[model samples]
Target: MAKTSKNKRTFKRKLINKYRLVILNEDTFEEKLTFKLTRLNVFIFGSLFSILLIVGTIFFIAFTPVKEYIPGYSSSKLNKKAADLVYKSDSLQQIVNVNTIYINQIKELLTGKIPEVIFDRDSILQTFHVDRDSVNLEPSNQDLEFRQQVEAVDRYSIFSEATKSADVVFFSPVKGTLTDGYDSQKRHYAVDIAVEVNTPVKSVADGTVIFAEWTAQTGHVIIVKHAGGYTSIYKHNTALHKQQGDLVKSGEVIASAGDTGELSTGPHLHFELWNEGYPVNPTNYIDFE
Candidate 1:
């Protein structure tokens, strides 16, 4: 016990031992600066300084832009820009895909390459499980009133006249027998007029051809934009006489009627008339008898 106590005293004395540090002028031998320090004080001061230095380095890296210079570190601005670029690239790719599809369809139309139709019997049968005999397909009173109001608004808006005076003359597209009538509930918003194959189909009014291309479901389709917010579509055509952007006079032959699409059962013209985006019965505008 005595020896241990003596050793502790020696260690404490060494830690507390005082030293004098002096800087003197070499020529004059005069002391310019002096410091009286103990071993313990020096060690404490050095440890404090090292701890402050480490803390300062951490603060500088965490709170300043210098952190961005470190390898594998990225700024918020650069990350955001990278994310935006990725989104824009994806959007551009989607647009390119859509345009490519349209271009391919146009090329097929120009080359007269109609795709062969493959009927999916299972898919068609899956959609027909409804009990057709029990369904009430007639429109309600409210539905009739809504349709009337819509028709009233369209007639006045297109002609700027009363309903009775809103009649506009339209040239018949073809002299044919009507095989099917317009049924919006069935999604068949056009009249199917059965005409002889290669029969000339005329434009119902003066218009510019907005789209003249072949589609997989509709074959050689032509859409015309006319004045008074009117539009016409002729589908299942074998050939189109007018290209997109061509202007045609009323009664001008625009396409030849034929069964060329997947939906066609025989040689016919699928004629649709639109007024401000709503489909209208073609029989109300043009006589197909």
Candidate 2:
């Protein structure tokens, strides 16, 4: 017990013990500086200093840009920029794929390779609502009167005198509301028909395709040369069914409507009629109700 008490006393004494450090001038033997410190105070001060240093380092790394320099650490700005670049690259790749498809279609047209025509019979029947069971044996009064007027005035015929009666028959190109009518003064030669997306565009008359290609202003445009110097133009299509040099029957599916070109506002078809190289109103000849 006595030895233990003595050890405790020595430990306490060491903890509180103080030492005087004096610096003296060598030549004059005069004291220049002196410091009085205890062992306990020195230890406490050193521990506090170490703790402050650690806290400062942690705060600097957490709040300052210097943390980006450390391995495995990334800057938020750089990460965001990388993500944006990846998105842009994906969009560019999609655009390239679309252009490639258009180019291949144009190449097939140039090579005189006609694409196979596929029709959605159900959609067509539903749109037109044609009743296959019913048949009108007798002509209506309106039809009889229209026939008389057509025969008397001959206003419906636009072809040459030799082919006027033969070329008077025309099939409606599409079933839609006419948004814009042909106006000679405004130079709007084509009639705009607004319709649902992927609606099939049909030919106005039996003709041979003379031009089928993509254009910057009109997108996928197809031109057909009919008998009696008549030509029909269909533009702003999503996909073309017939290529150049392909013979198309009246009311045959030629293309699908879409908003493809730069000038397009929505899915629609642009139809234009030309007679002897002069632009003519298509609505005058075909009744697209």
Candidate 3:
């Protein structure tokens, strides 16, 4: 009975040893000991791996350069060049004064009474809203004398008779009553609809929104360029409703009224209409009365 008991104990011991794990020796070609890896060790290794991945990604973005797209950044550069081409550097007021004086002096001495540039005069008055008062000088100084010369040369600016017509309309240019007739006097070529500040303004014609910008003189201004070479200008806006490149229909609300320019006495709309590249009396075109 003692021998049998000892044999049974020996058998159990051998079975236990057979199932024990052995880590094979890498270099010594003998059995090697091993430690059981705990869960904490595995968690630390995973955390370090994740941190390294995130840091590498951040470095790639911060150190590398990239490009961006922005609008109107080049407007200043391009506009300067365009302005130079479109107009002379001299002041329009100075040139007008000098030319006016020169023309009057020459007209007095001429025998033919100086053939009046009637068609040219009509066209110039038609285009820029030039009035006789605009060219008329006070007759006191050298600057005043020069206006006559400017008016004389202005004869060459008549429309080429080939300009195509572009239609126009108005929501409201100003809030005041039509105080003065659109005559050849005040040189107020554009229509003035006088209104208190904060009056809502809208588009007069169906067109593409070409400009919605702020200026030092005009304040918040919007310009819509329509087909047929026609461009409508809305100046002295209190706020703008639409942005550039928006397609707008006639009578669409575009801005609110305000006094924006150096020429403005009160809140008003200095609304100008162009027909095939020329400024015509807006009164002749649209029925805003």
Query: Top model by TM-score, which number?
Result: 2
Candidate 1 structure lDDT = 0.85
Q: List residue ranges in candidate 1 displaced over 4 A.
A: 1-167
lDDT of 1 by residue, 126-184 (tens): 45447889899999999999999888784323332122322456888999899999876
Computed on alpha carbons, the lDDT of every model, listed in order, comes to 0.85, 0.84, 0.69
Model 2 has an lDDT value of 0.84
Best by lDDT: 1
lDDT per residue as tens, model 2, 1-289: 9999999999999989999889999999899999998899899999999999999999999999999999999999999999999999987876666666666666776687956444333434354455766866789999999999878984443432222333547788999999999876666778999998889999999999999999988899999999878889998999899999999999899999988888887889999988776777777688889
RMSD (Å) per prediction? 25.9, 24.8, 20.9
Cα error, candidate 1, residue 91 (Å):
25
Q: What's the true lDDT of residue 78 in model 3?
A: 69
TM-score of 3: 0.42
- Of candidate 3, the 10-residue stretch with the lowest lDDT total is 65-74
lDDT of 1 at 196: 90
